[model samples]
Target chain A: MKPSTVPASTPSLRQSSGRYLQTKWKGLIIAVPYLWLVLFFLIPFFIVIKISLAESIIASPPFSSLLNWTEDGALQLSLLFDNYAYLWEDELYYKTYLNSIKVAFICTLICLFIGYPMAYGIVRATPTQRNILLILVILPFWTSFLLRVYAWMGILADQGTLNNLLIWFGLIDEPIRMLYTPFAVYLGIIYSYLPFMILPLYANIEKLDMNLLEAAAALGAKPLITFLTVTLPMTLPGIIAGSLLVFIPATGEYVIPDLLGGGNSFMIGKLLYSEFNNNHDWPVAAAVAVALLILLVLPMMLYQNVQARQVGVKT
Target chain B: MIHKRSRWVIAMLCFGLAFLYVPIFLLILYSFNHSKLVPIWGGFSTRWYTVLFESPEVWEAVMLSLRIALINATFATLLGTLAALAMVRFGRFKGRTLFSGMISAPLVMPEVITGLSLLLLFITLADIIGWPGARGFTTITIAHITFSMAYVAVIIQSRLIGMDQSIEEAAQDLGAKPLRVLWDITLPILAPGMLAGWLLAFTLSLDDLVIASFVTGPGSNTLPILIFSRIKLGLKPDINALATLIILTVSIGVLLAAWLMWRQEKQRMQDRKMASRTDH
Candidate 1:
């Protein structure tokens, strides 16, 4: 191919006005999505923040901002930190936040452990079986999520199918309280999010080099050593992806905890819902949400940094 | 890696698979259970399935939900593909990074936050414009479209990124207008991604509970909302029956899609083999 004959400042080298218009139109087409996101997602987050700083009034339009204490012992227009204090100083609030993170972390660990193996197994399987297993993982996802969770209720309740089966087999003296327990809550979350964990792991681990394993064998490394030295490091990307998939959603989960968790079992998500709906306290709820966002942001930023580093290496 | 007994690995795999399948199988079995107390088998019966057919209110809700999901899925797929096309065609610009981040945000943002934000927007809109929203099914459908479109956008973007861009340029060189170039070339080429996006959005709309619970007003219960409320009150065998029906339908749809793809691939291989033979 010949190099360009035109000099850098030549008129003939300039792009046409018709092409310029097309490029500008194309730029607007790109702008539409970003504009929609700013309006819907980002602006609402600021509004939530604004309202969170306001005084809590009972059940009568929660969005009266600019708060300060008045002569009549009512709060008026100015700034305050009590809503955040309600989230932090209270033992119940801290407990709920800890509980949300605790559950999400444990669930992410379990999902990684379980889903990684299955992903590996599926990748190793014949194409037909791989397709079949993948379909099995995705099939439940296609059904209504609440209905699938409801199906768990039928299996986990005191007089549930699991108990009845145990009773028939003479394995239990009484129908166990499997429903409305923390264990039951964990079961539901793990079951629901298993597919999320599997899919990401599948995407990454499926690309792993089989020759490495063979080479390790030829080099006289034991199976376990080879696994630790080769496979785990190789699959770390998949592990991170799978963990993120499980961890992020599990943190903000409301339905599983609400249905399966009893009154004493207070996850942060449930607490936020109650504050908004049951307690009619919007400001406190917003404060809790802001705190939740803060808690998630640190780890999420770290994840992005790591991903960016990886992309930097690749490119 | 550990060189555990193959028997041990096999047993573990079997147990896990059995755990997943048995719960679902039990749900199916209980659908026909004569016992109303669910799980306890009073006897074998077809009573729950029959009960499903008798409820006109249930039918009405299902029909309404179907209508909403179809509408939401179609719009989500269309907007998602357009967004994806714009994303890929306009590859890199000043704000491309910002655009990608915006599209991915809804996928990660909590459903509670999404629902509440949408609800707040609707209320503000009513105060401003006196609009066509009491924040009912229409609001819920639109909200569903917003998030579901993100997923569709992701899928279509990946598909477009992997695709050959030369085909479109070829169409343009053959004297196609920009609109006609897209319609005759890109639309047909991206049809599979579009269809996949439609299915993804439809499933997402069907599965949504928290967002729908927030936005759905005045007696409109999608099946998930109905099931959620019912489970909170107490479990029922009819739910099992309904779930069984849904599971079966989805499995069939997936299997059909797989079979079609396999046939298409096989035909492609045959075509290649024939062409190579002709060349030889």
Candidate 2:
């Protein structure tokens, strides 16, 4: 009966219809998101590139159109290279870019040193303690970022909590001027982005094979040697992931530099904001955005590659 | 060596936790200070809270933010779910790499760049299409949706990847249509993830200051924009009050989520135990 049923059922007819329905459903599902991204996310970048090449005009929208009609009914393209040239010629922009990179690099290093120990501790903790500890780590992240920066302002102000505490301890004769310095900027960045470093490292460290460390120890390796030779190399991906997570965002950080670093610190984010808002130079702002994107493209691609590879390994 | 390293790890952990939390506690404490100056400790009072409540602009901004967040969450979740399905279920479609790149790029993109590029896009669109008349509620909501959906897609994609597919395959084997199987079996399983994605999208939209700042026109200030503009001059007691309130709300929400997850884990354990006992 089963053998007779197979031929009677017409398997090709069922399969073809099912496949046809699936193709339609698949197309619809893919098209909606793909088109939305193209229209909003992808195409806007091209517009930025176009505007960066156009002259800044004193009009609504604030940039000259890229294309114009000539007298003889010919389309003319008017592109200005001055914006990029201006960014090149201005030493301020160059210095600001360098300074931002330096700040981000230093902060990333600090975060790694601080966050690694914490992540290792969490991984070694009991299950119940691990959950609670992780929640504590992530709690600040759930709150408002701006408010956290504001909290630091109160702490680091001239007459603020930290200064008052120090004076009570007789550690200082006068209230130290700490707010709005590069010091404040570094502290603010490290405080806010510490979680980004810790979470990735924790995930990576948690997945480490304990047997490898055991084997290293059995081979007459000391605890420190086992850690250095086995644990550290195993968590290299995590270290890279965490560093990139902190460094990439820190390079273009606007809020921390603006609120904490004040006028003393000049990051690319602040430069772009001022160029667009205060100076109203749309073309220059677009140029700054383009330059920032170019600088970030390498790291961004690295991060994406790491993430894709991780997902691939998992699947 | 292990024993010594454990002590150091504990100390580091304590220090890191304190660093993360002390500022928040201090900020909460200062909200009650009566003095206008933020650092000074006057007698504790609710004056700042009263001031925050009295400001009409603050009310307007809060209302506008809630509206955008609500609209943005719904649309972002819808689009994000579709994208996740396309990514995980569809498998190896045309332009798949570009699609995935767009989905993940926004997670790490700088706010200033995103804001500037999106505002330019809007201006160009207004000139060419003239549909979105002005850059206000609609524009800000769209901008929020674009980035927020990226986050939602990541959340749902992970959930989709971890899901057991045998149940879905079994449903299809029992003469269920593809869409029928999706509606009846797949979506119910994905409901929790979708809810999480929605809440995250809402929070992101509500918290955004930079992107909203770029796209906002006259008479369309969001809560973050209002808070930012006010605090840019100096720290305000009323904003401290606002911050305390935000922190309280977020804490309660996070704690509730954590508790729920804990309870769910315990229940799973007990069920497993019961099943084992019965089998014995």
lDDT values, one for every candidate:
0.76, 0.89
RMSD of each: 5.4, 5.7
Worst 10 residues of 1 chain B by lDDT: B1-10
- The TM-score of predicted model 2 comes to 0.95
Worst 10 residues of 2 chain A by lDDT: A12-21
Candidate 2: stretches off by over 4 Å: A1-21, A71-73, B276-280
lDDT score at residue A34, model 1, on the 0-100 scale: 61
Pairs of colliding residues, candidate 2 = none
Model 2 lDDT tens row, B1-280? 8889999999999999999999999998999999989989998999999999999999999999999999999999999998988877765678999999898889888999999999989888888999678778999999999999999999898787767676777888898888888888889989989998998899899989899999988889999999888888777999989999999999999899889989988999999999999999
lDDT of 2 at A127: 96
Regions more than 4 Å wrong, model 1: A1-28, A67-77, A299-315, B1-9
lDDT of 1 at B225: 79
The DockQ score of candidate 1 comes to 0.42
Best by lDDT: 2
List, residue by residue over B181-207, the lDDT tens digit for candidate 1. Answer: 667776787899899999989888888
